[model samples]
Target: VEVSGLPPNLNRSCCDCGVYALKYIESHMLNLPLDLINEDNIREARLKLAVDLWAASKDPVLIDRMEKYEPHNNSSDIVDVS
Candidate 1:
């Protein structure tokens, strides 16, 4: 639905678009109202995300994924930076 009457939207028209997108998916999945996440409560959402990630950090799968992400197989691979 192109709104010709309205001015064209420039790039990054919406601030924190990624945040909004993640919130949209979360709301849709949880059957929660999208309005639950807004500018005022965005910080709360981020804090919750941080808490969730921190809690999951102890999960073996997540730890393994992080381990694989480091690509350095041996201690010799790491340069000794004094």
Candidate 2:
């Protein structure tokens, strides 16, 4: 079944397209409103997803790499991966 009224693919990049697809599916699954899903805040959504995934990851190598890339001075755990 096709989902209607999903946010338009404004960026047109493969990465952005994937993000839109997943978000649309997720909203549909959760019976959430689709209005919040838009191009304007997709970058922020993507960043949040990345941080969440990174935090949840248990791979030692990836964790080490993330630590190197993530800021060490910040007291907050969230990485500014943007």
Candidate 3:
């Protein structure tokens, strides 16, 4: 698939390919028609649908790194690594 609108810095490597594939599958699966999926065949249908949609859709952007500008904790206390 040829995914567009991806960040220019997005990572594309074999190490992260599976992660990208799963994300793509999840996104597509959410929009699947309810009538096309049922309890008895949901498993198979989900896999098939995901594959088909992924094949037809564009390539996904796989992020390998991101810059964090702020601290996650509100406490000012610091821990000594030593």
Best by lDDT: 2
Candidate 1 vs candidate 3: the lDDT winner is 1
Ten contiguous residues with the weakest lDDT in model 2: 5-14
lDDT of 3 at 52: 77
Evaluated with TM-score, which candidate comes out highest? Answer: 2
Task: Write down the TM-score of every candidate.
Answer: 0.51, 0.55, 0.25
What does candidate 3's lDDT look like per residue over 1-82, in tens digits? 6343534433333344444445556656686433332234445544775787776555343222223245576877887989
lDDT of 2 by residue, 1-82 (tens): 8548544446565578777767878888998888778777888889988887877797888878878895558576778878
Candidate 1, residues 1-82, lDDT tens digits: the string is 3211212342133656666667877777887766576677776776787788899988999899888885646665668789
Give residue 56's lDDT in candidate 2 (0 to 100): 70
- The TM-score between candidate 2 and the true structure equals 0.55
Sorted on lDDT, best first, the list reads 2, 1, 3
- Local accuracy by lDDT, each model: 0.67, 0.77, 0.48
In model 2, what lDDT does residue 49 have? Answer: 82
Q: What's model 3's lDDT at 48?
A: 75
Q: How close is candidate 3 to the true structure, as a TM-score?
A: 0.25
Deviating ranges (above 4 Å) for candidate 1 = 1-15, 64-82
